[model samples]
Structures are given as structure tokens and as C-alpha cells.
Target: MSTVNTTPHTPGPLLRMSDIRKEFPGVRALDRVSLDVAHGSVHALMGENGAGKSTLMKVLSGVHPAGSYTGSVEVDGEPRAFADVAAAERAGIAIIHQELALIPQLSISENVLLGHEETRYGVIDWGATHSRARELLLRIGLDENPALPVSALSIGAQQLVEIAKALAKNVRLLVLDEPTSALNETESERLLELLLDLRDQGVACVLISHKLGEVMRVSDEITILRDGRTVETLTVERDAEGRPSVEEDRVIRGMVGRDLDQRYPEGEGTIGPVRFEVRDWTVDHPTQVGRRVVDGADLDIRTGEVVGLAGLMGAGRTEFAMNLFGRSYGRYVRGSLSRDGEELRVGDVADAIAAGVAYVPEDRKSLGLVLDDDIRHNTTMAALGRISTRGVIDPGLETVEARWMSEHMRVRSHGVDQTVRTLSGGNQQKVVLGKWMFTRPELLILDEPTRGIDVGAKYEIYLIVRRLAAEGACVLLISSELPELLGMCDRVYAMCEGRITGEVAGADADQETLMRLMTRTGEKK
Candidate 1:
């Protein structure tokens, strides 16, 4: 990987936390960990799920507060104790979490200057707020109107706005957690470029991400955490010829605590006869009348087959899946679904579930899970009938079933009663999987299942998908990551402008081939 040349005048140890130790009820979340970020340099923190990476950042950002953890935090060479988020901000530290904290109803200007609004004699100065917000937006290469509602911007643009909000705070140390997890390939590249620009402008950045390629490309230093301790810190080592080199294998070994010879598990199962089929399925935009989002899309998934759906963001893959799953998403939806040559009646979510179909949505927090609920409740939510009699839930039976399902899905939690909101992204995803698995569906539709999760967690999820297919269940996988589709699916259907434009065998699929098909112009009729 080519490295960005950091300015020679970069300052030393812009942010440092030493001997940090944190604990929970029965868990040592962080154990004597430490990190250092130099001004104008990008430092990346990486580890498998449940590792202490996030915990360490939380301590630094004051989410754990001063008395909750034992640590010495120094900002710009001055020792300081941060009691809360406000204190951290006062120390010029800003953290942007994976789940953005922006309010959708507010305008960009309002969201950017949220808590620290420009005021004239104690009254809010709307004009000055918009002016300064625009300047920050321009600094980050985003040229959108500051008056636009934050919800109007695309996901990529919204991410840039978040950084702009941080810049508005005069942040000297910026911490970004999985910033590119939801972005497409092009968007990810642009965001990396922006980070490099920030580094050049003397802002120290701490990036926590599961995408090792991005980490290796953008970071000057990488720290790997495992379990609850520091595993190793890595930098590009130069040889006698003064050429820098980083061993990808060594980084993987550090994060996973062992070497992973293969990233994806091989699926040795055979594809059986067509098990699920959708014919001439069409859906219209929910609010836009007469505008069809999915236009007569026809597709099929065979027993033991893992089929991939590849397309751009608005290509209607999700719309099609939602429409097929009991007409849950769109208006004026028309579809015909059949299993094993027999037509199925799917009028709503209940009917869909009764028909043995399950959908794991792309947005887990908003759709697939109840964040406030415990694993016990979330696990059995989709198939509660199995644990309930005459509308009354059997708590003991539910707990037993939840425990078994959590164990089967390898959900890492204190217990079944642990709130899902507190679990890591990988574990939360496992809970979603368990919820659907409890239903014993013959066909499973997973939409962006591994998004925002670590590499080790992704591998585990892939293994589960393979296991489902091997056991004679049909799996429909939808993802924007081309490599994921190529690695996991048996065949892929390329969608464009609400239609299936092309089909390719997964064994022969490459990024270029898939992209060409996905972006091809004509709609299939």
C-alpha cells in the first residue's frame, strides 16, 4: 500500500491514554490498554468483535467517565480528566460513532451547530450559523446547501456532514468508528481521501474499522486489540533499501489471535431443484404515485443454493425483497411467489411467516431487532408462537429456547437476559439471525447481513449461511460488496433500474463483470 506523506512538522502524541483498565459486572472490558495518536497522522484500531478496541475509545472519549476507569489521559501533552462528553469536547476531542447521532428532522446547519449554536446577545444567530456551517461543509469538499434537511442527503454525504460537524467543534483529535462501513466502493475511496486531507491539515485521526484494506491504505500506525488487552502495534517496516512493507498475514494473526489461512469457508453442498420462485413481481414507490421501484422482476432460489442480488443503492433490491416478503414495503405491489411448484398465499408478514419465509433486513437497529429488549425476547420475537400458548408466553420455556438459539448462533453475551443494545454489532446480528432461525424457515433472505461487523465476525456469519444452505435451505444474499457475493454465492443476479439485467455464475464473477452488468443501461422486460 502506498503511504501518504505526513508533514515533517507534525506534533508528537497529540492524544494519549495510558494504563487504561475498565470492568463490567463479570467482564474485564479493557485490561491495562494504552494508545497514542500523533498530530497529522492516522492511527487505526482493529480487532475481532468483543475485543477491547471500542472499550478503549470509550474510555478516551469519556463515555466511561473519569471514576469508572483507571487511566491517565493526556491531550496535547497536558494531563486532563474528562468527566463527560462535554468535557471531552472541551479538550478538543470529538467522536463520531458508527450509528450517526444526527437528527433527521433538522437542517444541516442546525445539526452541525446543535449544542454550540452561534448566538448574538444570547439569542440564536441563524445567519451566522448557516454561514459557518457552509464554510465547514466546503472544508470537507461537501458543497450541499446548509439549509437542506440532513435526511435529504445520501448516506455518503451524511457521513461527510458528520465530519464537518466535528470540524465545527475545532476538534484537534477526531475519532471515527467504521466510517465507511455503509458506503459503496467509490464512496469509501472518497472518504479515505478526505481523511488524508485532514491529516495534512494537522488533525490527528483515530480510525476504528473492520476493513483492513482501508486501514492499511490510510493509517500510519495500526494497533490490534484482542479479548481485553493490547495484542500488538504495527507500522510499515523499512528494509535496507528504505522501502516500507506491511505483512497482511501478521495483522490478521494479531486481530484473530491465530492465523486464518482462508477468509471464506468453502461450501461443498450441491444445489437442488428450484425451491422458491417469484414471477413478474413489481412494486411502486411508497409515496410517488405511478412510479414503479421494482418492474416485473423475476427471480428464483433453489434448495441448497446461495443466490446473490447485486445492484446499486436505489436499484430496488430491498424493495423487491420486502414486496415478496408479505408485501411489507411498497404500494401497488404485484407479485407471485411459489415454492416447489406450488403457489403460496402471502398477504402480510404473518402470512409470510406462515409460508416459511424469513427476511433479515439490512438495517438491523431499525428493522431487524428491538434494541431495548433482551436477547431472550428478541431471539423468540419472530417465532413467539412456539414459546407461547393462547397468547401467553411461557417465560421458562422462552428462556430455555433463547439460550439454545443464542448458543447455536454463537452470540457472545453475559446471558440470555443481557440487553441487545449493549451487545456488539456481530452479536446483535447473531441475535437477528437467531430470531429468524427460530422460525425454521425454508427460505432465508439476508440483506447486507455482515455490514458494520468485524472480519472475524463476517467469517462466522458466512459459515452460518453455508450451514443453512448445506442443510437444504435456500439462501438469498443481497450485498453491495462484490467480493462478498463472489465469495459466498452459487449464482448472482445483477439488477439495474429495477430490473434483472444479467445473471452470472459466482465461480466466474469478478468485480468488473458484476459492475458492468449492474450498471448496464437497459431495463429487462
Candidate 2:
């Protein structure tokens, strides 16, 4: 790895944003916020959803630009006025957002050196492009051919490609927003190791993540924000063995402005008789012929029960849920679904919804909600007929129902008329949940329901899930986090390679036991 510096530097701190205040139409997103990042160190930016963490980063990265906000940005003790993202890059700053910016159809080399490509006389130079791209890819530990399209790579590999593009710009200070939210455990560890390596190479990083364990591991300093204001910044204490010594509770206190005695709320719902059942479920890969994505899966969910599905990535947990919910994913080879002792003939999404089945997909942004639409429209999207008459929506009734749902879901926004994209991630997730809850389903399938939200928002979501179960709704909760399953579920089913390996009661389940089942093969339970 090589250290790249694009500007003349005499540094105490590598970057500083002093008293930044930004405002949208009716909201003051950021209020007099200040931050400083030391050279060759990792600084974590922690906060609950809508705490202005993203807004502050946008101000620093020139997304909001210079005149759009009131602030002074200093790089290496010299004031910098960044008119756009290009100007920020010239000053050796790059930001990788949660949603990666990469063209799917473009090759790895092309995406890496998209804008800053080498030219020969009056033409393009392919040889130099691939050579430089290969060098950057090696630095990030991504061993793949540079000519392959970015779509062929996993989410983790594509993330590394984004980093390679930043290195191509000679970035000295990098900002990563929820870098591992979409990754599996292995991929996340790899990315964290890469961050530590970059820090050792004299690059400063501003990390914004909701995962406290990862934030505590690699960060040198932690800054907490609350309600668009600077709370306090704490230096991470280290033990003699060089491990972090700061308690996670202390950081949580600063972010939510209170002590969270319990990270996961206790379930108060009582398990009842079986209300939903699946037998001999099998689904083949959509494009790959004769390959079963989900095979011979059987499960039962009782009324007022919160069941959990546990597995590693690509273990067919999601595939099984989607196949059961109106065959939304994969090609259904065989499956028998029954609800309330009656067989269901769910050929499509409408049929599933009509059969009282609701699915909240894992990728909420792409599959659940229309980002450009308002909360009112999204909340009423699943059951428009409830708020419509004579095949036309009533504007007054829509407002009444949407407002009620927003309040019921505890969505924080300017108004029901506010655009869904402008809200924070937690609030956006609330809208997705609200949309599905409007359908009044007997069985609700929540896939990775609390994937990217903060701890406080996660607790609220847990409460909502419990409330639904208490009201006699059967909930099938799928999560990658093991602790989540153990905390909120009455029973958990482990799947490995498209087969159910074991079933465990939540009271007796532990990480080790679940791991054994998740990795087991050859036997179906």
C-alpha cells in the first residue's frame, strides 16, 4: 500500500469542520456541528437515525457545497472552499456512501478509472488503465480480473472496487457511511481489516456506522451526535493488550441521550396453535437450471408466535420466504402452503396478499417503498382499496389513514406529505412497515427488518413486532444477527444449504448451537 497526498500539508489535524449549520425546507438538519479528524487515525461518527450524521458528512464532502451551508472547512490548517465534490476530491477527500456508486454494466477497470483515465496523444490508453487499476485492486486485497463487469462481483467485492476508485483519486481522507450494512460477517471483517491497513498507511477515515462493536474495534476516537448537535467526543481507551476498553453503553448513552438498560425488549406475546404451515417446499434457481435454491423445507408458525429463521448468507432462508409468499423469487418446483387449515393457491403477489400474507423484503429501498413518493402514498400502497371507493382514491380519506399509520408506526418526519427519500433511514423503514401493516395480514414475513437502523430505532421496531404478535398475528422474523433471533423469537429454525437442519426453542438456543445447525449438512429435520 502507498500513501497518496495531493496537497501541501503541515498538519495537526488532517481535516476540521467548524460550526456547520445546515437547514432544509422545514427542518434544521445540522446545527452548529463541529468535527476534527487526526492524521492517520480512524474517527467514528455515532448517532441515532435522523441525528444529522449524514447531513454533517454531506457538508464536509461538498455534497451540500460551500454556500449552501454555514461552516468553515479546514484541511491541514488551511481553509478550503469546496464548490462541489470534484473540488473536495482535489483536496484529497473522498466519501463512499451506504449505497455504492458503481455502474453495474461497466468493467472493474473502467469503473475504477472512469473519470481520471490516461490518454495517449489524442486517444485512450487501455494498457495504462488496466495496469493502474490492477495495482489499486491488489492494494485493497481484491484478487480478480479487472476486465470482469462489476455486476459479477459480490457486494463486498464491489465495495472494494469503490475504494480502489478513491485510491485512484489519491485520497488522503476517506469517509465511509455504513460500509458493512449490506455485507455478511466474513465480508465485514475483510473491510474492517482494510480500514485498519489504510489507517496505518497515513490515511484518515471518518466512519459512520450503527454497529457499535465494529465502531469500537477500529476507531481511535468516537464522536456522538444527538438531534443535529454535537454531544461529546470520547477518546477510546486501550488496555495493555491494545484492545479497546470503552464500554458500549457509554457510547449509547451519548447517542440516544439516555441509558438503554435493555438493548432488546422482552417479548410479551404468548404462543398459540399453529396458524400457518408449509410442507415439501422446493424452489429452483431462476436462471440456473436444475439447481434447487430451497429444498424440502417444512415449518409451522403459531398464532401470536414470533418465529425466527437463522442461517448464513445464501442458505436459502430468504429464498424460502419469498417462494412461500406468492413465488416472488426463484421458480417454484414444489410447495404446499396452508393458512387456517385451508390450502392457498397463491400464484402471484396479489394472490398472496388476498390470502392474508404480507412480505417485507430485505432490500426495503428497492423492493418495498417508492423513494420519490410521499409517506401518504407509500403507507396506502399495499391496501389502496381500504382508503378508496368506486375504484378512485379519496384524498381526504388517504390523508386520514396515512396520518394514522405514521403515528401508529412512530415515524419521525416533517409531515405525512414529506417525501420518503428526504427522511432518515429509520423513518423510511417505518414507512415500509406501515405500508405492509396496512394490508391486515394474518402472516407477516419480516426479512432483516432491522438491518441498518440504530439501536434506539431497533428497539422501537422490536416493540412493534411484539405488539403485532400479541395481537394474534404470526410473525416470521429473519435476521443475520444471532442475538436478535434469541432475544425476540419464541422458536428458531436453522437452515443450511436450502434444508432445515434443526429446530431449537428460543429458551435453549445459543450462538454455538445455532452455528452447528447452520453449518450441518446431509440430514434434514
Candidate 3:
């Protein structure tokens, strides 16, 4: 049996990646990148979307085989070559991707022991697997039965399952790519605690995240990547001694390549008369129809008004908006919606469009985009019927519209023909926004609008949101980030346990108050 050698005061670098290089067809994904992570320290990789953060983690985990890139990776003072993921796993390297790699139909125990299932004389050992999975769950502060189907679990619970899977691998080094991207405050904190526990157990972790605040909170060292190159590697402590003053600021500057005066921009303007309103609205959960996700809700947005929906992960904020939009996402939805003082029959997404409404869903990769198609195709998907003539599609019109949006939104791409899948998360989100924006709707519903976006891209989206509101278009912003909502929205509605617990004007809203309402459990007002 092998044991990991790790401690806060342990000597030498446990892993060093030197002059790493990887190139995709037309893009240089990684170029001469170098980063060093020490045992027992949480090293954070920070960068804007497509800044090659995930690529580096993949390389280390052998997702991109050792031969696929130009680099030298030394673990425990010895050079190594990992032919594939299995080899990497054998070498104590384990990575959990941003998008979870779990099969919904599989049981929790099955997911934990997927690749290396327990067996006795070529027979599946279900009893042993369940016990092992249960043990791993305990390490993650969970006590759920291993036999439960993964589909029965919520996204947050599923994340814990992934963590357990990593533990099953006897990992000495762990890599988490945007682990908290979809997590709410409580879930995020819990996940962080588990990582700390693992670190205490002598495991090293590499955290890749765009959330700078959380990154700053947990990271022992920081590495910034830019345009596939390693800009700098920042060591938080020097030989177990804290760095000098201004070290944090120095790290932030390196990550962004400039000093960002603000984390979120503050803007104010006139919020004009009731453009959209929802009264006595309710939406039930998808699986549990009898249980209401949103009990009864009331919301209003005036022309040029930016209304923010603030809540925890299960606060029912998204459910309320989704059910009212076009009835496209929820089940057993009963809602009354009005637009411009007239009743709106939002039966489905198309009906919502007819009422001058547009929705940008939260999941861009799955629901918001056509992965195999080019950007031009995805940009015009929502309004294809409008762009088409008598059921015969007009490629010329689509191309023209796509080109205009690509330039207008400042989407970075080789051309409109570039595959949407190849673009960065932020750029893909822009495509989602562009598709809905091009329709020229009177009211826009943005769900987590700036999520997973870098500081520079977030600034651009903020400007876009402000511009839209300034143009007398109603904006409904739904986000988990309290700072963003408070900074941009004209008014904020705080939801808790599927109801609007409180509503506050933007001028008076703050993290403390919003969070108070967001986490409140009981009959929501």
C-alpha cells in the first residue's frame, strides 16, 4: 500500500508542469505553460474563459494523453508519461470535470465504481461496491444510501457523488474544474469544507474556478493563464510564512492583466411603467407534481426597468420565471402573466415570443446551444421561422444576421462558421444572448446572465444589460450572485423556499439582507 506524503510544512514541490504546450486545429490551446503545485496546498488556476485553464487540468489528468501535448510533468521528483486516464489514475491524479460525468440512470454506488467496478471471479460485486461507496460518502459528510438512483438526486447531491467517486480512486492529487459553478452558497461552502478535509488527509488539490472571491478564499497559491500561456504563478506563502502586503492585489492584477477597479459596476437610471407583471403565479416541481416549487408569486417590471431575482439554489426563482415565460420548463404551472397592461397567453416558448418576450436559459451547453453546428446556425435558431421564407430557410439572411451579431456582441471567433462547441463558455453564453436579443423583444429574461464569465466578459455583459434597459426594454435578471443583482438591477426580489419572501429597491439592497431572505425556510410570503 502506498501513502501520500503531504503537510502544510512538507518540503519540495510535489508536482511541476514545465513548458506545457497543446494545440487544437486552429487554436493554440496551451503554449509553453508552466505551473508548480505543492503537496497539501490548494493551488488555484485562474483565467478568463478559453484562457486554457481546463485544458491544463485535462493534460495533467491524462484526459489529453501525455503524447498529445509538449510538456514535462514531474510528480514526486520523477518524470512520468500517462498513456491514458487509467494511467493517470494509477499515478494518483484524478480530475472532476466542470460538466459532471455521471450517468443519470446509474445508482450512486455504480457511479462511484464505474470504470473499476468491484468483482468476484468476473461477477459484479454489488455488496462490496455499496459498502465502499457508503464509506466514501462518509468522507464527504454524506450518509445517503448507495443504492439510490442518481436521477433521484438534485444537482447539489450529484456533486457530492462525484466527490465520492474521486475518493474511491485513492487520489493523492485532485483537480476540480469549476466545481462550484452551479452550486449555491451552502453547497459551495460544504464542497469547500470537504476539499479542506481531503487536504488535511494529505491530498493535494488543484482548483480551477472563475469565481475570484471563492478562489481567493481557499487557494494557497494562484496561477494565472492567458491565451494558452502561463502569465504568472503566485505563491501565497513563502516557506510557510505569509507574503508581504499587497500580495493579493498583485495576484488579481496578474490574473486580469490589469487592475480592475470594481468587481461589479454600479449604474442607475429611470425605471419606467409596468411593462410585464405576474400575479398569483405558481409552478410545481417537474418530478413531484403535487409539490409546488413556487407557491404563489407576484412580480412586475416596468419599461426600462431591470428587476433582479435573488435566491439560493432551490429558492424557486428560476421556476417562477420559467413557468411564466412560455411554459417551456415546468410542469403543473398555473400563472397569470400580463404584458403592456394586456393579458399574455404564454402557453409555450412560441407564445412567449408573440408577447414580446425572450428567455435565455441557465444551461447554455445543454439547452441553449446546438453543439455540432456552427455559431451562425446557433445564433439564428430561436428566430429561424422569422428568418425563413415560406418554410424554405434563407441561408443568406442567417449568415447576414449571424455576422452582424458576431460583430455587435464582440464575440471572439475565427468566423461565423466556427463550431459553437469550440467557443469558450463566455462566448457561448454571448451566442445565447444574441439569439434572444436579435428578436427585438420588449422584455428579456436573463438567467444567471454573467455566470462562469470572466471579469472582462462580465463587464461587457453588464454594459449590454444597461444598454438594453436604457433603450426602454424591460430586463428581468435572475442570478445567484447577489453582488451582480444588487449592482445592476433597479429593484430586487428575494425568494426563499419557492416564494417571494421580500422585495427591496436596488438602492437599499445588500448581500446580508438578500441572503437572509434567500435562506429563510417556512411559508414564504
**What is candidate 1's local distance difference test score?**
0.88
TM-score to native of every candidate shown: 0.95, 0.98, 0.91
Candidate 1 regions with alpha-carbon error over 4 angstroms: 1-11, 237-244
- Residue 101, candidate 2: Cα error in Å is 0.9
**What does candidate 3's lDDT look like per residue over 363-428, in tens digits?**
888888898999998988877886799998899998999999988888988889999988988899
Question: How much is the lDDT of residue 469 in candidate 3?
Answer: 87
Better of 2 and 3 by TM-score: 2
Indicate whether candidate 1 or candidate 3 has the larger lDDT. 1
lDDT of 1 at 100: 90
RMSD of 3: 3.1
Cα-based lDDT for every prediction: 0.88, 0.92, 0.84
Q: List ranges where model 2 is wrong by over 4 Å.
A: 2-8
Sort every candidate by TM-score, greatest first: 2, 1, 3
lDDT per residue (tens digit) for residues 1-525 in model 1: 122333343256887788889999888898888888887789999998889878888888888899998979887777888899888988778899998989999999999989878899999999999998988888888889999999999889999999989887778788999999889888899999999898888888999998878887888889889888888788855577744477777788888878888887899788989999989898998898999899888888999999999999889899988888888999846768999989999889999999999999999999999999999999998988999999999999999999999999999989999999988999999999999999999999999999988888998999999999999999999998888999999999999989998888888889999999899867683
- The candidate 1 region of ten consecutive residues with least summed lDDT is 1-10
Error of 2 at 78 (Å): 1.1
Error of 1 at 281 (Å): 0.8
lDDT at position 98, candidate 3: 81
State the weakest 10-residue window (summed lDDT) of model 2.
2-11
